[model samples]
Target chain A: MALLEIKNLHVGVEDEDIKILNGVDLTLDTGDLHAIMGPNGSGKSTLAAVLAGREEYEVLDGEILYDGEDLLELEPEERAEAGVFLAFQYPVELPGVSMTNFLKEAVNSVREARGQDELGSADFLQYMRERADMMGLNADLTKRSVNEGFSGGEKKRNEIFQLAMLEPKLAILDETDSGLDIDALKNVADGVNKLRSEDRGFLIITHYQRILDYIVPDHVHVMLDGKIVRTGDKDLALELEEHGYDWVREEAAAAA
Target chain B: MSTTALDTSVRPEDRFISAFEVNHGEALNGTNASISKQRTDAIERFAELGIPTNNLEAWKYTDISSVIDRPYTLPLAPERPSLDTDDIAPFLIDDLDAHRVVLINGRVDEVLSDIGDLPDGVVVSSLAQAGSTHPDVVEEHYGKYADFEDEALTALNTAFVQDGAFVYVPSGTVVEKPIFFLHLTATEQDLLLQPRHLFVAEDGAIARIVEAQHSLSDAQTFTNTVSESFVGEKANLEHYLIQDQGPSASQVHTRAAQQKDDSVYTTISATFTGEVVRNNVTIEADGSFCESNFYGLVVGKDDMHVDNHTFMGHVQPDCSSNELYKHVLNDESTGVFNGKVFVSRGSQRIDAYQQNDTLVLTKDAEIYTKPELEIYADDVVCSHGATTGQIDEESLFYLRSRGLSKRRARILMLQAFAQEVIDEIQLDSLEEHVAERVRTRFSSYFA
Candidate 1:
C-alpha cells in the first residue's frame, strides 16, 4: 500500500447533494511529490478537504486508506495525529491564540496521539525556535496571534513553517500558491524542499504552473470537470502551460 | 420602619425592608456624623427608588424581584462569627506579600488581616475607622462619585454601609505593593452583607486595589457592595475585582470612580461563579489627558447569570477610554453586557472605544450584549461593537487539523478569547492568576 491512497473516491456536500469529486483515483507512495493542476471547480480542493476529514464534505463512495487504515473513519484531529497535514487555502486567523501557543499544543497533541510524552515548556520552546529559524519565520511573527494581520505571503510561509514543525508523513498543500509573489513562492518551496525525505510525501494542488517552477513535482495530474483526465511526468505541467489547459479540456470532453 | 416613600406593592413579601430597618436602627448612627446626612438621604432615596425591576432600560435583562423575596438578615451590627487566619488563607493569593484588609460579613477582621509594610503616609485602615479618624477626608470622597439618587443598588448599599477596606495614598507617595482587599462573606445563617469602601489616591500617588471575594457559606449568602475610587491629578490607580464566590452566592457590586487631570484609572473584573451577579462599573473622566480602561471577563454555568453594566463618561477633552468585556456562558448560563460611552458636548478630541463579545458553548446558554455610544462632541472619536456568536468554526477546524481534539480546540479558542482581556492587566502576577482561572473554567466546559 502507498502512504495515502484514494481509490475511486466520490464526494459531495453532505447537506446538499452537489457532487464534487466523481470517481477520482489517486495514490501517493512514500517519497512521492505529486501536483494536481486544474481550472476552477475541478474538485482539486474537494479532494484535499475530503482527505482531511472536513465535516462539510461527505465521502459518497469508495475509500481513503492512510497507513493501512480507513482515513474517512478518523476525525480531522485524528488524521492530523496520524501524520496527514493540510495547508489550508485561506489560513484561519485566530485573534487570541498566539502562533507559538498553537504550535506548542499541536506538537504535544501529536506526541500524545503517538503515545509519547509531551514536551516541557523550555524544551518545546527550544525545539520550536530551531524549526522557526529553519523556515525563516521571525520571532515577532511567531509571537503574534495565529495568522492575525499577517500578509498574504506571511500566511503561506507560516503554513510551511508549521509543516516543518509538525513534520507530517503526508502533507496536502491546497492552493498554497494562490496568493504569492515569485520571491514568496520560492521561499515556501525552499521550506518544503528542506523537509522532503524518503518517508514523506506531498500532494500540491494549484491552478497555475508558476509555483511548479520552484518546487518540481514528481508527477503532474491534470483535473477537469470533477475528475483527473491525465497523469504525466513533470514535463506534462510545462506542456499544459505552453499549450494551455484548452487541449486537456477538449481531450476530456471528446473522450466523455 | 416608617418608610412611606417605599412602594410595598411591588414585592410585598420583600425582606429588604426589614433588613433596612435593622440597619437604620443600628448601623446608621455609628457612621461618621458628617456621613450620617448622606446616609439619611440615601435611605430615603432607596425607599423612593425601591428595588430595581426588569422593566428599567438599564436593567432590562436582570430581574431582582425574586432575589429580594428571600428572607435575609443584613449583617450590619450582628455578632461577629469567630474565624481565624487559616479560614481565609486560601482566599488570599499565594503569590504576593501585600497590605491585606480582610472584611468579614461587612466588618473588619483586624486579627486575620496582614498589613505588611505600607509606604509612609499611606493609610490602610478600615472604612469605619477612617470615617471616624479622618472624617473630613472620608466624607469628601466617599459618595462623591456614587449616584445614589438614580441607582437603586447604590442607594441600597449606601443606606446600610458600615465597614470595608479603606486605603489612602497621600500626595507624592507610591504604594509599590498591591493592596489586597478581601471581602469574605461567611456565616452560619442567611446573611445579606453591605460593604462600603472608599479609596482615595492623592496627587502623584499610585496604587493598585485588588477586591477578591471569598464565600465560605452556602446558606444563601448575599453581598451588596459599594466602592468609590478617586484618582487625583497625575495619579495612577489600577483596580481589579475578582469574584470566585460560592455556587449559590448572590452578589451586587457597584464601583464608581472619578479621574483627575492627567490621571490613569484602569479596572478589570473577572467573574467565576455565582447564582446571580450584577456589577455596575462607572468611570467618569473629569480631567484632560486622563486615560481610563475597563476590561471584564465573565464565566458562568449551571443556572448562573452574570450581568455587567459599565458607563464610561468622557466629560473632558483629550481623554481616552477603552472597554472590552467578554463572556463565556455554558450549561444554561446567562450573561448580559451593557456598556455605554457618553461623550459630553464640549469634550473635543475625546476618544472612546467599547467592545463586547460573548461565546455561548451550549444550546441552552444565552447572552444579551448591548454596546451603546452617545456622542455630542463634533470632534470626538467613539466606536462601539458587540458580537455574540458560537466559537469560530474555522478557527476550531484549524486547531483540530493541527492535531488538537475538538474539545481541546474549543478550550484553546475560548482561552485565546479571554487572553485578549487578561493581557490588558498591567500587573504580571495578576495576569497569570486570571489566565489560570480562565483555563480552569474551560476545562469543566470541555468535560
Candidate 2:
C-alpha cells in the first residue's frame, strides 16, 4: 500500500451541497515529491485544505490513509500531529502572539501527539534560531507577532520555517510560491529540499511552473475540474510550462 | 450567610433609609461647612436613589445585594495608624516626583506621606483644607460634575465623604510631578471609608494624577470613592486609578471628567483586586475640539468579580473619544463590561469608538460585555463592539509546536491579549507596573 492514499475522495464546505473535491484519487509513496499543477478554481488548494482537516471543509465520501492510519478521523490539530502539514496559501495574521511562541506551541504539540517529551525553553529557542536561519528568517521576527505586519515573502518563509520545525511525514505546499519573489522562492525551495528524506513525502500544489525549476519534483500531475487527469514525470512539467494549461484541457477533452 | 436571612425589612424603595436617618447632627469638629453641606446633599441623594439593584440596566450583571445585606455604619474617625513605607515603595514609579496624599479610614494621614514640590499657582492639599481655604473652588466643582442622582455609589461616597485629595492647577501653569492619592484602608474589623477627590485644571494648564486604592490588611472592608475632574479649555490631564486592595474587600468607585473646548483628557483604570469591585467612569465633552481616551485593564482570579461601566458623551461638535478595555478572567472569576457612547443632537462631526475584549481562561470563567453607540447627528462616526472568547487554539497550537509547554504557551497568549490594550498606555512606567502585576497574578497558573 502507498504511504499516503486517497481512494474516491469527496469533500465540500459545510452548509453547502456543492462538492469541491469530487471522486479524487491519488497515491504517494515515501520519498516521492508529487506536484499537483492546475489552473485557478481547479480544487488544488481545496485538496490541500481537506487533507489538513480544515474545520470548514467536510469530507463527505473519502477515506485518507496516512501510513496505514485513517487520516480523516483526526482533528485539524490532530492531523497536524500525525505529520500532515499544509503551508497555507494566505497565512493568517495573529497579532500579539509572537512567532517564537507560535512555533514553540506547534512543535511541542506535535511532539506530545507523537508521545515524545517536550523540549525545554532554551533548547526550543536555539532550535528555532537555527531553523529560522535556514529559511533566511530574522531572529527578531520570532519576537514579534505571528505574521502580523510581515511582508508576503516573510509569511511564506515563516511557513517553510514551520515545516522545517515540525518535520512532518507529509508536507503539502499550497501555493507556497505565489506571493514570493525570486529570492524568497529560492529560500523556500531550499528549505523544502533540505527537509526531504527517504521516509517523507511531499505534495507541491501551485499554478505556475517557475517554482518547479527550483524544487524539481519526482512526478507531476495535471489537475482539472477537481480530478487528476494526467500523471507524468518532470518532463511533463516542462512540457506544460512551454504550452500552458489550455493544452492539458485539450488533451483531457480528447481523452473524453 | 443564608440568602433568606440576608433579605430583611429593608424594602427595595427604602434601602438607604436607616443609614441616611442616622445623622451625626453635629458636624465632625474639624470639618468645614462646605464639606458638611456637600456631605448632606450627598446623603439626601443617597436616600432618594438608594443602592442600585440588578433591576438597573447597567447593574444587571453585578449583584450588589450581598454588599447591602448588612447595614454598614459609617466608621468613626479612628486614630490614624503608622504605615511601613517600604510596603508601598515598590508601587512608586522611579524618578518622577509626586505629592503623596495619604488617606486612612476616610481621613487624611499627613504623617505617612511626602508632599512633593508644587509649581507656582498650583495648590495641592487635603479636601477638608480646600473646603475651608478655597471654598469657592470647592463648592463650584465638587460633586457637580458627577451624576449623583443616578449613581448610588456616588451618593454613598458623598454620604460618607470625609477626606481625600484636592488638586488645582492655575491657568497656563504646568505641574511637572503627578499628585498621588493613596487611599489605604487598614482594619481588622469591618470598615467603611468614603473618599472624594476634586481636581480642576485651568485653561492651558497640564496635570497628571494617580489615585491608588489599597488595603494593607486582609480583613473585610468596604471602600466607596468618588473623584470628579474639570478640565478647562486647552488643558491636558492624565489621570490613573489603580485598585490593589485585598481579596476580601469590596469597593464601589465613580470617577468622572468634564472637558472644555480644545482640551485633552486621558483616564486609565487598572483593577487587580477586591472580591467584588465595580468601577464606573463618565466623560462628557462639553466643548468643541475636545479629545478623551479611556482605557482599562482588569485581571481577576478565583471567585472575584470585576465590573466596569463607562459612558462617553459628545455634547458638542468637533470632539473625539476612544475607549479600549481588556479583561483576563481565570478560575471561576467573572467580568462585565458596559460601555456606551452618545453623540447628542447638534454634535455634528463627532468621532467616537469603543471596544471591549475579554479572555476567559477556564470553562467556569465568564464575561458579559455590552457596547452601545447612540448617535443623534447624521454627520458623525460612532462604532462600538464587544468580544469574549478563549485564546485561539490555532495560535495556541502554533505556540506549543515551538517546543514550549502548554502552560507557558497559554501564559504568553494571555499576556499578548493583554498587551494589545497595555501598549496603548502612554505612560511607560505605569504600563510596566501594570504588566508586572498581570504577570504576577497569573504566575501561579504557569508555575
Candidate 3:
C-alpha cells in the first residue's frame, strides 16, 4: 500500500467558496522522494497544508488515505503521531517557549502515542545537541524562545532541526529553502539527505530548483492551476528551470 | 403635591465610617500616640473619600460596591483561629527554604510560625511587637511611604492596622533566606481583615520577602491590606506577593515602596484565584541611579476578577523603571491593568517603559488595559503599550502540528504567554512554584 494517497482532493478556505486545491490527486509510496515544483499561486503550499490537516482549509470533497486508513479523519496532532510531519513554510514564533522544551514535548508526545519509552533528560539533551550540530543550529538559539528574534535562515534551520528530532515517517517540506543562503541551503539539504531512509517518504515542495541539486528527488512533478500538470524523473526539474513555468502552462492548456 | 425629597441612603463608606467611630477607642487601646494619631487621621481621610465607585477613574473597571456593601464582621481585635501546620501545609510552597511567619486573620501567630534563627541585628517580628520592641524604627518608617490622602482603601486599612509582619534589616545586613509571610483567613463567619506590613532595609542591606494569602473557609471574606517598604541607600529588596484564595474571598491590596540612592527594588505579584482582587502598587524613585521593576501575572477563571494598578514615580535623575503585567482570563473572568509612569521635571536620563498584555479565552471574558505616561522631562525616554488579544492560533497550530494534543497545546500556549512574566522572577523556588501554579490552572481550565 502507498504510504500516502490523496484521491480527488478538493479543498478551500473554511466558510469561503474560493477554492485552493481543485481535485488534486497524488500518491507516494515508501522510500519515494517526490518534489512538487510550481509557481507562486499554483496551490503547492495549499496542498501541503491540506495534507497536514490545517484547520483553516476545509476539505470540501476527497479522501486522504494513510496506510489504507482515512487520514483526513484525524487531527493534525493525530496525523503527526501517525508519522506525518509538516515543516511549515513560515514557522510561528513562540515568544516564551524555549526550543529545547518545545522539542522535548513534541518528541515525548509522539513517542507516548507510539507506546515507546520517553527519553530522559540526558538522552534528550544529547540527541538535541547532535541534531542541532548536524543542522548547524546555534546552541544559544536552542536555549532562547522558539524562533523568536531568529533570522529567516535560522528559522528554516530550526524547522529542519525539529524534523530530525521528531523523525516522522512521511515528512513534508513546504518551501524550506525559500529564505536561505547557499551554505544554509546546502546544510538543510544535507540534513534531509541524511534522514532519507527506505521506510521513510518525503514530499519536497519548492519553487526553485537550486535545492534539488543537493537533495535529489526520485520524481519531479510540475503543478499548475491546483493540479499536477506533468510528472517526470529528476531531469524535469532542470527542464522547468531552463524553460520556466510558461511552457508548463502552455502544455497544460493544450492538454486541457 | 407629593414632596420630592432627595433619596439619601447610607453608602458603604458611611457604614464603614460608623463602624470606625464605634470601635475606634477599642482598636487603639495599646497603640502609641503616633500610630493612634495616624489611625485617626486616616479614618478622617477615609470619611472625606468614600469607597470608590465605578464613576471614579481609578475604579472605572472594578466595582467594589457589591463586595463591601454587605455587612462583615471586622477583625479589629481578631482572635487567632487555631490552625495547625497540617491545616496550612497546602498553602506553603514545597522546598521553599525561608523563615516562615504565619498570620491568621491579620495578626501574626508565632506558635504556628517557623521563623528560624536569623542573622544578628535583623528583626523579624509582628508590627505590634515592633511597636514596643523597636519603637524608634517603627515610628520612623511606619505609615511613611503609603500615603492614604486620596486612596480610601489604604486609608481604611490604616484605620484598622492592628498587626502584620514587620522586618527590619540593619545596615549592611542581608537576610540570607527569604522571609515568607503566610496569611491565612480561617473564620466561621463573614469577615473583613485588614493587615498592614512594614519592611525597612537599611543601607547596603538585602532582603527577599514572599507573601501568600489563602482563605481556609467558605465564608465570604474581604481583605484590605497595606504594606510599606523602604529600601535604603544601595540596598536591594525583592518582594513576591501571591494571592490564591477561594471563590468567596476578595482582596484590596496596596503596596508602596520608596527607593534610595543606588538601590534596586523588584515586586512581582501573581493572582491565581480570587473573587475580586485589586492590587495597587506604587514605587517612588527618590534618589539617583535607582532601579525599579514591577512584573505581574494574573490567571483567572470561574468569575474571578483581578485588577492590577501600578504607579512608577521617577522623581530623581538617572533612574529607570520597567513594568510589565500580563493577564489570562477564561470562562467569565475579567481583568484590568492601569499602569501610570510619572517623570518629574529635571529627572534627566530617566528610562521608563510600561506594557500590559492580556489574553481572553472565552467570549464572555474581558480585559481593560491602559498605560498612562506623564513625563515632564523632555530628555527622558518613556514608552508605554497595552494590548488585549486572544490566544495566537498560529502558535497553537504550530504546537499541535508537532504532535501535542489540542488540550496540551492550548495549555502550553497559555503557559508560554505567562512564562514571559514568570521568567522575570529571580528566586528559583518562587519561580518554580508560580510556574507550577500557572500550569495547573491552565490545565484545569483547558481540561
User: For candidate 2 chain B, which ten residues in a row score worst on lDDT?
Assistant: B1-10
lDDT of 1 at B238: 95
Model 3 chain B scores worst on lDDT over the 10 consecutive residues at B1-10
Q: Give lDDT tens digits, candidate 3, residues B1-447.
A: 111111126777777777777677775555655567788889899989988999999999999878887667776665767779899999988889999999998899989889999999999989988888898998898889999998999998888677899999999998999999999989887888888899999999999999998889999989999999999999999999999888999989999999999999999999988899999999999999999999999997989999999999999999999999999999999999999999999999999988989999999999988888888998998988888888888888899999998888888888999999999988898899999999878878766
TM-score for each model = 0.96, 0.80, 0.95
Chain A TM-scores, all candidates? 0.98, 0.96, 0.97
lDDT of 3 by residue, A81-101 (tens): 999999999999998887888
Off by over 4 Å in 1: B1-26
Q: What lDDT tens digits, residue by residue, belong to model 2 across residues A1-256?
A: 6789988888888998878787789999999999999999989999997887666788889798998899888766677778888888888777877677667778888889899898889999999989888777787888888899999999998888889889898999999999789889998898888889998999999998899999889999998888898999999899888998998899889998
User: Which candidate order results from sorting by TM-score in descending order?
Assistant: 1, 3, 2
**Candidate 2 chain A lDDT trough over 10 residues, lowest sum:** A96-105
Report lDDT (CA) for all predictions. Answer: 0.87, 0.82, 0.90
Ranked by DockQ, top first? 1, 3, 2
- CAPRI level of candidate 3: high
The DockQ figures for the candidates are: 0.86, 0.22, 0.82
Error of 2 at B92 (Å): 5.5
